[model samples]
Target: MAPRHHEAIIVGAGFAGIGAAIQLKRMGIEDFVILEREDDLGGTWYVNHYPGLAVDVPTTTYSYFFEPNPNWSRLFSTGTEIKQYADDVADKYDVRRHIRFNTDVEGAHWDEEAALWRVALGGGQQLSTRFLFTATGFLSQPHTPDIPGIGDFEGTVVHTTDWADDFVADGRRIAIIGTGATAVQLIPELARTAADLTVYQRTPIWVVPKVDLKFGPRIRTLFDRIPLTQRAVRAVTDAIYAFMVDTAVLKHRYFRRFNIAAADLAKLHRFASIRDPELRRKLTPDYDFGCKRPTFSNSYYRTFTKPHVHLQADGIERVEPDGIVNADGSKTVIDTLVLATGFDLWEANFPAIEVIGREGRNLGKWWRETRFQAYQGVSMPYFPNYLSLASPYAFLGLNFFNTMEYQMHLMDRLFGEVRRRNATTFEVTEQANARYLDRMTEALGDSLFTLGNCASARSYYFNPAGEATLLRPMTTRRAVTEASQFPLSDYTFA
Candidate 1:
């Protein structure tokens, strides 16, 4: 029997996929299906429900620009609220019907003769689509550190990505590995109830104070009644974050003082929260503030000052059945182990699933062998009719909505041209892709990742090649402008 087909197949029903679906519908191209691996559609929000999970980015700037939710309960909304926002946006845009939950896309190959993509699914099912989009986010794959004897451990082990609802941490001896953004949030929550909490930190993170204000009824009413009021708030929030990204990361050499000031703010926060000088020293990050992704929390720093909490910076030697052995030869027995090791960004998640483009050019293998890149962080050479929403240099600032909004503009422009020419296939020109990669490489030289000290930071921004290719080295305005105004000649349509 012939397999099911659609005009477009979007892998991953996350926000990015939903955005893409909305864009397609707006373009009068509605014959598409969103394939989601999970049973739900919230992507990271749906997948991650760890304790104390909340938006690190401000609620005003974190949501979709087109569909802003004025009813956020807090300045930094919780994971449940974010998931509900996703659902609301999906429903409002009428894209929910197009989504196929629990549908896993194993691989996809470009069919030259058929001029379409053949997507392979987990249960031996195949689907064909004229255009293929991979919206599997950067943080889609959860990374488990290869600690010795982790497999032989007798206790319950939980990765932050797969947190169990019934797993109780109250009064239980617990050890958590990693100090990334996720760990920063989880640690404080665990510290509150755990009888004994041990945090195994490889590198300390820079934390700033989170100004999380609960929204009052009046504020919500003001936002709902006067939509422009919410827009103004969003603009202000966007500007503040954009200033941080510009001065601290994008143009660190010219504005190093800003970076220093930000670091000092974190230091002041740390000093105020923790009383012990030794503990403060252990908690402080040695690297520059913008080197790694910084987070904001009111209670994270103070959580370490608790009597029962311990900070283990000596590194992990191995994990035994009962507990973990530190590199200093000390051991701590724990009943539950939590791994907040973050995601495998470059290795397992660049192209989350196998993608074989024209002439058997594998996307993942090509990126690793050569260099990680994508033209305008969307289109790639030899990948005809394909768009990768989570490609390299796509992320803009701390908020993902900035990137998504600009990419939506790019989609509008690119697909508008495709419709103008009445073309069935389109691919970015090799010269164009190469030129864009060169421009990105040159521009990154002035950025914090290149000029700033990041040796001890262990940032996910830097790919395995030691290149900070994750964020585009330009302002959000320029990104949107370029995305909308890039030359149509850059892509060949047929």
Candidate 2:
């Protein structure tokens, strides 16, 4: 028998899930259950434990707005530290008492008769709720490269998303598969310890030098002692970062010059740092800077200069008994394999969970039919009272947490409306959703995805139609402002 009833059911315990729970609690919505698959919290942070795993965005900018951690150890924080911070947030909010840890949400279907969502758990426990919130963020799942011989590889293999602490690569011959953002930050760190490192690169990446600096003792003490000073400092830093990616990336004079400087800096760093021109060429990318998520690495370029490190630009053909074989028939032997390939950002990493909305409509099929359109990336038309925290176009290159906070704010308003109207459900109208979807698609088409410059084969930013879905092309402020205004007029009340 399913544990039968609650006012709300939240699926994940990550940044987004926790955000929703905290906001709901503040709004006096206490009858809610946060279902976490793992025994602990920190959704993405808990999973990705690879070497040199850390936040790419600056520490001052990437945290919660309401409660900023003034005591971060570095400008760019590591995975462990961030995870601990998430755990801290959970503790501070007393959110753990409401969370059902180690409980995996199997599936959820809307029961038309009761007008509630029936949520199934792995342990055969069930919960019924008036609304379902999928805070299981878009990037929670690990995507493995579909190479033929992946299973046959005899050496120790690991994915950056599921890295185990017990695993070691200290003196082992390691071959890293993907050269995405994770690879950029980690390769350099691995070089300092690995016996021999070979990076199999399918495409070249535009490498930019990270100007990471540690805060002085005075600044740290000041920020810790005076909270307002920390908030002011964080605000200033956030604005500067927003300008760089949001406005600066689009500007002709400033951003273009910035790209040239980036390339030149890479060349200078490589020239002074790496002696091998061929290796440098393989490491350098041809696309415009910020064409993809620009990685932060001060030592990645320097890593190539190491005697034991090898960068193979040739495409991976297949996995041999010892290591990877390139398209050009060249092979490098390694005892350990690390896949730095990122997650399926579009699928929202909750594919295993079956979500059946009105008339038994599956969420996946609905997305597929509509090309992944959601009104402000939150509530879909048929799926009433459903909100995805970091859904389509909710991603801002500046800092993901700010976007998450904004979405949480939007959810707050929606829940408020639900309470005010004495309504059990509020579904987005199809006409409004379609109109917004068209506008968003037009906006994206004018942006970088269709700009003929981005060169990756496929990324999680797109829908099933190969159209970009995860990001809105507008500025961060505009996106947030637009998301904040929910058209109660567009929602039908019951």
lDDT of each: 0.93, 0.77
- What TM-score would you give candidate 2 relative to the actual structure? 0.93
What are the per-residue Cα lDDT tens digits for candidate 2 across 281-347? Answer: 7777676556666666778878877789887876888897788888888878889999988887655
Instruction: Return the TM-score for each candidate structure.
Output: 0.99, 0.93
Per-residue lDDT, model 1, residue 313, is: 92
Residue 389's lDDT within candidate 2 is: 64
**Candidate 1's residue-wise lDDT over 1-494, tens digit each?**
88788999999988899999999999998899999999999899999999999999989999998887888999999999999999999999999999898888899999999999999999999999999999998899999999899998899899999999888899999999999999989998898888999999999999999988898999999999999999999999999999999877898889999999999999999999988999999998889998999999888899988899999999999999999999999999999999999999988998999999999999999999989999999988989999999999999889888988999999999999999999999999999999999999998988899998898899999999899999998999999999999999999999
Pairs of colliding residues, candidate 2 = 3-126, 393-470, 393-471, 393-472
After superposing candidate 2 on the true structure, give the runs of residues whose Cα lies further than 4 Å from its correct spot: 248-272, 347-352
